[model samples]
Target: MGTDVRDETRNATSLLESNLMAAAKDLRNETRKATRTLERNLMAAVNEIYKRITALEQVLGWYRAGNYNLYKVFTERANYTESLENCEKYGARLAVDGIIDATILRDLIDNLINSTDYGTYVGLDDRAKEGTFMWLSGKPLIAGEVRWNSGEPNDDLGGGQDCAYIRAEAWNFDDHYCETKLNYICEKMA
Candidate 1:
């Protein structure tokens, strides 16, 4: 009778262990399925966003550079004030960051533009106070951050060369008259 009781106890323990192991295996399989589904959904969303951006780039002629804003090169020539207004109409502003990237600006010009002798107008100007250049965003344009043209940012005579522009020949800032009509780059800043 004691042997029979001992055999029954052992059988019960073995059954319990087997059930627990099966349950654990089932839980792991379910977790893996959930993770794979989440990964697939994330990839699909990313692809959709990429397609929309590509379509907009083609239609609006807006180009984007590495870690930079989406910019559009307007061939229509306009002076400083007019260019500012034009960018505003499109719900954007001029690329008037304190530090301008001459290489990216040059790539946008050389690759996108066909011809322009008047150069392109940026938002830097000394209009508020003479000899004190500032961006359109009310930030001062640091001299060290810019690649100014050779002997640039100088007014040969009073009220001359107050506005800054990027020359087509090279990607460097050159002071120009505010009224000079030139191509522009309207940047949609992030």
Candidate 2:
């Protein structure tokens, strides 16, 4: 009877150990599932925040300098023609060439576009006739009013760089091929 009792006790201990092991495994699996769900929720929240920020930025027009509102489209890149069209959608025009406007644009570009190795298209271009740069407002860019990059107005490249752009590091207008796709800035009257 004593042996029988000892055998029964050992069997009960073994069963308890098995039950504990199973419970531990189940807890571990549940913890893992909860962790995965939390990560997914965090990602969704982050994406929503990013979308909201972008929408807010569009409404704010990027920057307000003097009497004009400047907007730089750094995400979407397009050629000279396409850029003009895009600006039209926003009820604005490609940035024009004026002393104050150019200065404001240069400062904005220096802060934003300078870090990237990309260029931003400006409104000034000599597309209709070479060596005669004109702004989108039908006014020619007068010499000495605004500075251009050193050795610029070099329309000697392929197809002659007719479109003007503000380079990243230089922050000065330089002629570029009209067909070359690049980021662009838009201007609206405040």
Top lDDT hit: 1
lDDT values of the candidates? 0.78, 0.77
List clashing residue pairs in candidate 2. none
Clashes of 2: 0
Clashes of each: 0, 0
Question: What is the per-residue lDDT of model 1 for residues 42-99, given as tens digits with 9 covering 90 to 100?
Answer: 9999999987986887688877755457777787899988999999998878776422
- How many pairs of residues in model 1 come into backbone collision? 0
lDDT of 2 by residue, 1-190 (tens): 9999999999999999999999999999999999999999999999999667657765764655544465555548899999999989878888773223666655666555665678888788998888898888898878875568898878865457899888767677789988899988787655
Give the per-residue Cα lDDT of candidate 1 at 189: 75
TM-score of each: 0.77, 0.62
Which ten-residue region of model 2 has the weakest summed lDDT? 97-106
